[model samples]
Target: MSKTFLKKRYGLLVLALTASGVALATVSQPDLPVAAAYKTERVVQELPMPKLTINANASSYWRDEEVRTGDTLALVLQRLGVSATSIQNFTKSSPIDLKTLELRAGQIVSARVDSVGDVTDIQFFRDDDNGERNLAAIERINGKWQLNTSNIDMETMPSLRSVVITSSSSGALSRAGVPVEIRTSLKEMFSEKFNLDELVEGDSVSLLYESLYFRGQEVATGDVLAAEVRTQGKTYRAYYFEHGDTGGNYYDENGNSLTRGFDGQPIENFKRISSPYGIRRHPVLGSIRMHTGIDYAAPIGTHILAPSDGVVTFSGWKGGYGNTVMLTHDNGVETLYGHMHAYVRGVNVGTRVKAGDVIGLVGSTGRSTGPHLHYEVRINGQHVNPATVALPTPKLSAADLAALKKYQQKTDETMAAVRGLPVMVAQRD
Candidate 1:
């Protein structure tokens, strides 16, 4: 009975397992449509692409043009697309006195334009001989325009040289084939120490001046880097140095102050003067008067070098003094040059003239008897005879002293090398 019951139960269990397996297989498998039943359809659609078009007629809105020679304000405006009416109105209603078109060459003119090609604004910058810059601005206003002028303070360095032609005139430097530029610089450099008109021919000068090099070309003279001048067998050396604490100044090898306080005056660099410092019979005044400054009569216009760097306080006519230029130095010293024949055009009152700049030509313009520069030195408004004044030498810091020692060593070696080669004397003393 047990064997027959077991066989029937096993047969039923196998049939149930088979049915469950078939249901599980059907649930796990996915149903897909037949390739033939589904029609093969392809969709083709067009897209909108952006087409970029650039306007070829539009000109550049900004431009820079260097002011060339013979370029006037009108021409510059016209070149920048300023309309005729705008130009006329600018000329008419402009507050600036445009009668004198003072535009100069080598200046930079910047213009801003609008979409309609009208100049919005224009700026012109020009440099003057005093190393200061003048900026003129033209702006559009209510279909018209206005011009404004302003000044830009600039530090200028001018390198100049001149030769001594005669033993009696300051212009001797210029006459002896010394470039006018250098002659002017020499005057400025020694304005405080001596008068240019008193220089004589036989004087020798050597200078190292600063220049600005742009694109491997010297664009302008910057400053008097260093200089040495020998007048009448007297050697004078000057060097430019910037103080770590104070800033820019000129000094000699000894640590003493070379700057005058007033504006233009002489610093130390000379020995005993030919003329003593005291009240005596005036050469030109023809009366007994105080000889304010000691005279170093070499020749006329030998090459008045600057005693120190300073500014021209007054450079025109003074009461009795002919064609005089007064320089105010940095160390509260003021110097005066009288009897000048002519002056450098750019130098004027309030103009910053560095050391060794020529302020004027030698002439007996004022109460002078001969072509000589009446030189004077004043300290704090008091006249100090430059001949007797104990000028202070510039001091050097320890670090600077060390550096100077190294430089002197190198300079000595260079001088020795040059001396070893050159035995030919160019000029006889």
Candidate 2:
């Protein structure tokens, strides 16, 4: 080939575009957004266009190759026709070592190359241990390579699967290409409905969940959106809903929560009810007053257990209540414990506590006649009768039920589109 032809073959296609115009619109809303989520505006203006060429006769195009089971940046780029210099720049100039980058088997590494095999730009996502993806890129800009990074939200689609159990649940799910993560999620999602381990030989399961994708390959599985289980001629269906207060939880067809609820009362070493939650005669004030919380008659220094999983919001002295502790749980529920004799060591604001965890002790620190615990349950800042209170589930919300119906309709449509072909790709709304 002529020198002019050789020089032209190795020419680079400069990107007139800049990363500033790259709008990566992310829908911060959790699983299954409302009707307004029909529009997805992610990557409206990417830095490098899909395909480009220097001349009509040039054989150049963008190529996307998946990282194999045991592959490195050098091996994958060499197979993608990237030059030695560009490959070196990509490995050395990346924010993290490209070799040390944890690349999943099906991860997509994209590159655009010229006819002479010199890469113009290369891009891929590097995921942390927490499964969050950050875009890392190296592009030839102004005759020199430059790196860029930003938070990324991968493409999500509804993945449908139907399988019958003839042997074991894990074996059946694994044979159907369901990842172990998704399998574990399916078990937990349907634990309240039916035990996955107890599924009989003829039992069956139909599921709909999110499949995260990059470059047309599924990289990971997301939250379980909906599922159905059929066993012994009985069918149970569950749909996931995102409540305004509760982040995400599953519910049955009649809007019953499938999440495992809190164990019973807050205190374990209880003796008797000195005062119930309501209007009653105050022993210390010596007047009829509205008692906002239930006073459990327990010995001083008795252990106080958290009703459920919650974050400590307050753990200090209050005016009349003296030493107090407050916990904030999901679904707009908050609990307050007053007149504590002593607090559990390391119990403070922002500390997470699970059910049956010791948070404080019971004592009549405030204006009280004897040793007792004043426990209050509040829903949306309004005091309620703690004696007759039950934890509210996400399905009880009218707005959540309506949104769930809409999501169910959309899911049916998606499933109908692939009646026989179970595995298909359709962008989530």
Candidate 3:
């Protein structure tokens, strides 16, 4: 802490450099003594060493509580062992606006209270949309409460997972020690082509992803860099590559977009494909009949979105179809949606809608047995199979394709290292 202490730390360095036959002509050290002038002395009296004082209650600490649904400030503070008086004092003296302090579910708040029912320290780490953490600390400084806000550094780490599926994709990933967010990202990445609900045993998948962490704890997942899946003797691979400065998108081995220009499914979250679009026995009529549309079972009020850009052709009730809505798209493509609890406001006949726009809610409005969505895709005037319909995929340019190939090769090397897969060895005689 003092000039003398700093000089003592660097004394050895200066002596070593000087003794190596290197003349230290520019070095200035007026206070340093020469070896001939140095002398040892015997102490006539010894000075008593000062005793060290330690706080007995310093180990008593704070607790953290995640803000949950229906949790108020007082409730969260009480859960963290902060007394009522402490909460009152914290609320009154804190500089942060109470209205701006909107406690969201999953946000963490930490607090420590003293023996006399007073708040000694409190901290809350709030993360924003831009992946930045705003740390707010309330502590007793100089015998008074002080509120301070600072920024903490964030880090991202890459992870890899390889799993052999014995049952479902989610189950296999869980057993492979994959993070929840990574599993969700992988599922969403291949939602258009892969039917996660229809996975069979013996299927396998490998994934590489990035996780955003703060203070050594993972808070969010960035993107799935590369993923490969094998099912039924067929392999499907998707690699995330950015084209120019636009943004990154998933592509297959042939440098084609993983998803079609438009999504195929009408409902994002469906309980199951209650019935596929084909000839099947009617559940209610007890007779083999032509099933014109696919049935997606969902809750009573789940959102139903437009598969692609189109104009609403019909938005009212149809016989046996319940509250049905039909949209006319380009290239003689038309889509029909039925069994809606209610149509989204402003969605009506002749109203133009974009792809992925919410059109209605899932319901059993007309002649139906339960809550579900009856989706039908028609080309020209004839009904077509929505599940097997061939959709259009975008292709990458020549330059972009070359870049992607290089990136893919590097990613493959990283994946092999992460999984510790065996490499081929060369032997010479």
lDDT of each: 0.52, 0.66, 0.65
Best by TM-score: 2
Structural similarity to truth (TM-score) of each candidate: 0.32, 0.43, 0.42
Off by over 4 Å in 2: 1-95, 99-133, 137-181, 194-205, 211-222, 231-233, 261-392, 398-403, 416-422, 425-429
lDDT of 1 at 425: 16
Looking at model 2, how many pairs of residues clash?
0
Return the lDDT, model 3, position 293: 60
What lDDT tens digits, residue by residue, belong to model 2 across residues 126-165?
6542112444556666656666432333466777877778
lDDT tens digits, residues 1-429, model 1? 489866765676668778886432222223345667556789999999999886534354655554557887768877877677656766676655666656555444667665565565666544322212334456666556665322322223333333333455444433333333334544555667766567656665555444332222222333344555666667666655554322234555663434443222232233324444332333443322334454544345544445667788887777567677887777656777766677777887888877666676556665655655556765544444343232333457888767665654543333333231212112210
Candidate order (TM-score): 2, 3, 1
> What's model 1's overall lDDT?
0.52
